[model samples]
Target: MAASSWPVKIYNSSSITTDSLKVPLHAFIRAYDAPTPSIVVRADTQVFLDSLAFQDDGKVLGFDLDHDGYDRLRNTEVRYLIDVYMPTRSLASLRAMGSGDVVVTPSALQNTSVVLTTAGSGTVFVSAPSIELANLNISVSGSGGFQWDVPATKVTSGVDLSVSGSGTLALSTTTLDAGSLKMAVAGSGKAYVGASSLVNVSSSVATSVAGSGQVNLYAAGTCRDHKVSISGSGDAFVSAMNCRDTSAVIAGSGSAYIQSTTTLATSVAGSGRIYVAGTVPGGLPGSYTPMASPPVTTYNAVPVPAYEPHKTKFGSHVSTGTSWTRDNATLIGVLVAVLIVLLVAFGVYRCRKSGRACFRSKTERPVGYARKTSTENQAPSMA
Candidate 1:
């Protein structure tokens, strides 16, 4: 279909590919289950489609913005709202080849896998309620930023997130129960993974920050077998309730703070600092460097008043004045001793009052008794 023939308006056109797309500045790209898979690019202003192709068993869609036999729309200040529709039983894959901001929400996708790459100041937002994918791979090598609002059940399989060329990436999720999660930041970029509950990495998690980049990860629950590497003045901070058998390597003046792990192994070099909490099996190895401790303050103590003892009308001795300390163990021992003495004295008094010995000799019997043999008292037996 031509760009003008669509149900939307059109502006000036430039000669590029034979197809033209007219879409508004702000539009909605929706995907729904249909009898046949089709793509409709509706724009407020007319735009040309340089190239569009479907490959990979009709499961992939690739589009390029071209004008005047040249790909100028990608580098120009033009934005379009893209909507994709797929079949009920088909899984679609999207590849964005332009340098623009791409925002993906859960409502905009069903069963899909995404691969996004841009070399401009682009921004990609993945804010979804629930996202289930085979894999997720995102690479941004510009001064752009990528923000991912992970849902409660996020990332079924593996996730590869990378940001270079001073780009920034942020991920927020309640739980990341994936097979594996790998994140890397280089060229002065920054990356953050914030988990509200626990970042349950079923397989492994590896993070690297180099070239003055920074990476911070926080998990409220246990993280199993995580590895972190920082070099070239980069800083990495990781904190979890308990981390089992974790490792960290810091080189070239980089720093790492791993807090509250059941077991940790650290290797540091070049004036790097590795701060670990909990237990380190054989202590830190290699050029082990400890973090600096905070300063302590001193305070003056107050004097306590002396204690005074008095006897009440009920004949119970108690402390009459303030400032008294009671030794619990000593008090308990004394009470037990007094209880034993009282019990013995009461027994003796009872024996004296009753005029009977409290204990009898071993040879004495309780009452009068006489021993009789069988022959002494014999009864007449029938012959």
Candidate 2:
């Protein structure tokens, strides 16, 4: 229906013609209510507003009797309705449907017995509910998707459905084509999807499976955690990487407990613990293999020798060694010390050639640059 609040003018009985009838919002509005600005529907009937009241015998006149009251009713569309022609389009709530294909709506409450049944190949979507469908068989054919707004309270076999929430969906029967099903949990919600045969899932964050048949989980990922509890006759195969940002735990407790039918190969950082109560007829796979039978009875014993203490060789060869990593800094320090000693020795050798006085007393004074002295003795002129 076009969800709006307009002045509703529909037909009423002859008994309620002259009498006043209060109008309700959206659907029900009666005659002689008011003669204000209304959606006048007097085309078929002879209903008209002569005075402040309606002058009709069958049709309803939805105008205000008081001028101010009509203006107030226009603002607040109470006791008014627009024509409803809401064809099913948006997938909302769903109830127990017939054995045929159905559409979706929001008001499909749980008490309304919400379910989507398909007799043919068309798709059907429904809201999640924990109710009963005593003798209802819903068949969704190949290559079709059925989405439930909420997680199912209870479900039946041959039903391929997807739920989007963190609510628990109790599985009454196995969800066939579980790989075809798409599910997303809020944080770390749990799902117990089991089956009699193989359940092939395409994309799911976290889900648990426990049934007599194989459970194949594929393309499952999420930022939160998820887990699967297995208690069935067949092996559970999680083909997808059951990787979560938080902790994800998978457990198995059964006679034929096969935690991984496939290889669990990853380089991520996590811990996995295994516990086994009793030994099974079949041996544990991979790392949990059993010990070999037919224990060795005896062997020729060798005499033990003593007194062996060899020196450790650390360089090039085992037998012979070299000074590859000897004291380099010590050698450099020795060389520097030798250079300093040589420099000191050279300085001493040059200094010993003259008296230990000022450099001015080392050589004969220069003739031109000689200092003036009153006691200067001039040498005789040489020939």
Candidate 3:
């Protein structure tokens, strides 16, 4: 079943044929053609190891799970660096033998097994440009899906090659995934390479985003969970900092543009027409993205509004039937003195029912006039 892309090199050292192989411990080491034995990893099962003097293609470096050869490799970290005591998961070359490889999932490790021992000197002790983890020589690119690449001889982790995926493509010590690849999770998944993402500096790439989720993109065969998309045209240069999304969906349609450090909850649906230059903080709700078709045609402007102070916190108070508090100016002066005493009692009851006598608020007085005149006349007479 031949179908290996990108700089090809299945387990170099010249393709392997069994030279210095000792896979000791209880040694099962199946997969010569598959029946399930040589530490079976199933699917495209392979078994070959005879790198003509370990051309570095054939690697076997410093393994120290506290020595004793990792107690004969059962499973540690993640395995299959390459069968027997396993450890040599090949992406074809460019490797670093972490010598603790294992990959025998017959069913969540059912009947779980591990028994391998080795006797060297048959030729296999090569290391070039390695930086710990046993041996180092690198080159790897693999994918079951989500766009994949990178493979062209130069691996060594017990002996070049290793990649098992349901999702999440990895291998630390400086990783550079090349093109547009995507991944989901569960075996630690993630891969996407739109925007012409490339990295090739001899091959030692890493400067953060070293691990932990998110590679969701929607297009050219979609991808999901905790998204990472780029559509239509692509122009990206995202740096990276504090991101913890269990499943935060960030969508972009066609003209894709995303900055970073974003947060929002509940209802947020955009149907186009959202153009912001920057700085619009304080609260943020007021036509933030509600362009329901209007005289829309704005460019280079400033209009930010959305602030409700509530005049000193929680609607100040001013009832008056007995008492509330905050006296907003004595409740407008007792509602303007009860509207001027109800307009002087309705104008003295409409001047005593229209008979008219509401002069000084109801004028009607002449009863003592006569008595005053009589008293004046009498006094003159007596004198």
Candidate 4:
């Protein structure tokens, strides 16, 4: 049964392995009750779209509703909600397009690829935490921006980023292990990437067109085989302590801070400066203070013991450990005291109810004989 008022359109790719399933951008996507354009892609038992406003070509699932239809629904009380569900661990891909603010949530895109492109004034936010992404590509053509939080692991492929206009790209990743990384910026665009663990860079550059472009790459752990460039007042910052075979080029009034432990090379022209990690020759440029190295990560390897219930002498299950005994000792003593008091009270009640003496006083008479009075004692002498 479908979960909404409308019927769901099902798409299955269980038998296909040649390429990942694709969801092309179409309608003004929404997440049920939200007012912005958004969607959620996560693992499910079945593959279906919680909407009736889409097209399925057995290869591509795309939204077909136009902006006019979206606007009409937005003005009225009707809601335009869409959610995409995929089979568990299945290969999938999504492309985010068009001219509005968009948000992709949960980042449960395991074994998935994503492409983001926008040319409007609104920003696109892709939240991917602790996922294994195969590939990610992002581009911005106007003043719109992109913010992606991808703490990716086991990524066997590369990441590509481009910004051709004045927009910004805030891309972050935690690379347990990954392949190459490439980025480019033009026309006053800015790109910022913070990568942890091992980071590999083929090329990263900032080229100025109408204004200066800037690319700042902050990497922790080992950075290997990096090629960075800056042209026409553009700037670059690469902060990695253990860099191997890194090359930097500055063409105009740009500056860079690159630290390499194995092989470091730089070429500068037109009043640009390059800062190395440590001491340099007398004719070389100034040195920079590198960021502190990331703390070493360690994991506990010991297996935890399973829990077992403790059996008491009466064959009743009780909690184990000294703390449990300590906590219940006073309560058990109180309960025993209460039981003794209740037994004494019950015996007294039974003696009174049956017209018998439960306890004797010193002045009381015996059970079968009366006590002698003072007159009986005097009469016994007379007799």
Show the colliding residue pairs in model 1: 22-43, 23-42, 23-43, 23-44, 24-43, 24-44, 29-83
Worst 10 residues of 3 by lDDT: 374-383
Q: What's each prediction's TM-score?
A: 0.58, 0.22, 0.19, 0.52
lDDT of 1 by residue, 214-255 (tens): 666664545567788876567665544245667887655566
Q: Candidate 4 — which residues are off by over 4 angstroms?
A: 1-56, 67-79, 89-92, 105-119, 174-176, 196-211, 280-383
Q: What is the lDDT of residue 323 in candidate 3?
A: 24
What is the model-wide C-alpha lDDT for candidate 4?
0.45
Check candidate 4 and list the clashing pairs.
none
Backbone clashes counted, model 4 = 0
Best model per lDDT = 1
Return the lDDT, model 4, position 203. Answer: 30
Residue 13 error, candidate 3, Å: 17
lDDT for each residue of candidate 3 in 1-383, tens digit (9 for 90 to 100) = 32231122133233332222322111122223322122211112121111101122243211112222232222322212233322233221212121111122112111111111111101011112212222322121122211112222122222112112222222222233221122222211233322222222222211111112222221111111122222111111111111121111111111111111232111111221121112223324432232111111111111111111100111222221112232323233333433433354445456557876543321322222121100111110000
Q: How far in Å is the alpha carbon of 247 misplaced in model 3?
A: 18
* RMSD (Å) of each candidate, 1 decimal: 35.6, 42.3, 37.3, 35.8
Q: Over all chains combined, what TM-score does candidate 1 have?
A: 0.58
Clashes of each: 7, 17, 59, 0
Where in model 2 is the C-alpha error above 4 Å? 1-91, 103-205, 213-216, 220-222, 234-236, 244-383
Best by TM-score: 1
Q: How far is candidate 3 from the true structure (C-alpha RMSD, Å)?
A: 37.3
lDDT of 4 at 248: 73
